[model samples]
Target: MAHAESVRVVFVDAETEEEFARTELAPGQLPDSFEYETRLDLGGESWAVVRADPPSAAQFLRSGSLVLTLRRIQTVDPQEMAYSLPTIFDPLPPTEDSTGSGEHFVIHEDDWRQAELVSRQLAGQVEAEMRAIHEVFRQSSRVVGEGASSMRVFDRIHVRRTPIDPLSTEVSLRRLSELLPVGGRPYAGVRIGDDPGRVVDSFVIAADPLVVYGQALGDRVTVLCLAPLLDAATESAAGLEQAMREFDLVLADWCSGRLLDASAVGAFLNQA
Candidate 1:
């Protein structure tokens, strides 16, 4: 898995570009169409300026439906963008490690049967943790403002409980259509979790006789299941954590740009 591209994508509704620019983060530098202000180069990737075009005014009335759009007025010089098309993959046994990017997971180098067991167990844990988060947060509210004189920060934080299901019962190419939106298909293989079951909605990542799903439509949360094919792994539960570490070993290359183009894309495209 390659690190995300440095090329910035500008998003907008099917509306006037000038009108959109006024609402942007660095109104001085970026164009709503051709270029967007880079958070690293500039200051912030202002979330305020970039928002999902509301499906309808009514959606805003009931917590807006998030529909994002990316518009390009000019092509990003792939060179200038500094993103890699190369891909790195996790190998089997002795190499797997436990490295996660928060609520994210991946599984590598495990047999299909072991992958199944790993996926199911982690799914159960995620479900239970989600339940616990909701139990503590949902249906609870607090007095936001304290003093009358001082202006409050941002009122209150009302987090809604969005209960999600297992990203997948198992992994396969056919499932990419379901994971990504139409046109959101990924071109590479992505892995998550050190153990076998972290069924996250990411791209088809490459790593030893892998069992993977494709594309995420840019979802960053990595609460995914770790799963791989059957032939390479054994049915032994005793070495679960070790297998996960072996998989984790590949992250450095992935982060540094060794994992993007590793797997032959011919296999994936054929499935699509």
Candidate 2:
């Protein structure tokens, strides 16, 4: 198992809703760790986005709307920090020399079984939910710089459906960009097709947190989140893997809308 600097799980709405706000939400629905919070006015109504700062954990929950994120950051020395930091000038390097930097994972049959266990714990069950399925994987590596310092890089690939199609990939990628918070230099290119369906083609590059690529199918969308490892490293690779797996388990629940269940959420909030 490889060590992870941090693990982040996010849920995004396919379309923006006008009526989301923090004021309308009950504080009990949010995690207690969320001490610092703020709201943004999109259109005339107030759309609330709250954040809480806890050691090693961070959450950004947008109320009445479509985005929620859970992040675990790894704190490292300046030299180690180089391994995961993202710079505006540098485009993502080709995956030739940094082979050992990361790993790839796919949601498997056993994973679905584990998710079913999580669903069983939920009290308020999901009534009607979208059947969209999302597959997420990560690639991590350390890149040496001009000096002795190195930056750690994390690349995530999220796919909705399989059987890659060229025309579909192109059109889906375009629509994915439309939903993001705009304002960045646009970059695109095609990667070799041998690794179809995955983010094996052209992508976008921007400052630190980059939305490398996004593709949609039917009502489901796939997006890539690439950035530096911003958390402290664990003592062992197994420990890191444990942390990642736990996050992935919850992620499966979130994708299934099981996380919206009141009882199920208690478990996620209680996790350290």
- List where candidate 2 sits over 4 angstroms from the true fold: 1-171, 190-199, 205-210, 214-223, 228-272
Residue-by-residue lDDT tens digits, candidate 2, 1-272: 23223333233222442222222233344443434554433445443343322212223232222234222233456544422221111122132221222222222221211122122122222222212222221233334455666443523212222111212122233433443333445444323223322233324433213222322344333323222123312222222223234323222242323333223333432331
Runs with alpha carbons beyond 4 Å of true place in candidate 1: 1-127, 138-168, 178-181, 184-272
Per-structure clash totals for the candidates: 43, 20
Q: How well does candidate 1 match the true structure in TM-score terms?
A: 0.19
Model 1, residue 201: distance off in Å is 12
- Would you list the C-alpha lDDT of every candidate in the order shown? 0.30, 0.29
TM-score of 2: 0.19
- Candidate 1, residues 74-124, lDDT tens digits: the string is 446643342121112223222233245433324433221121112332434
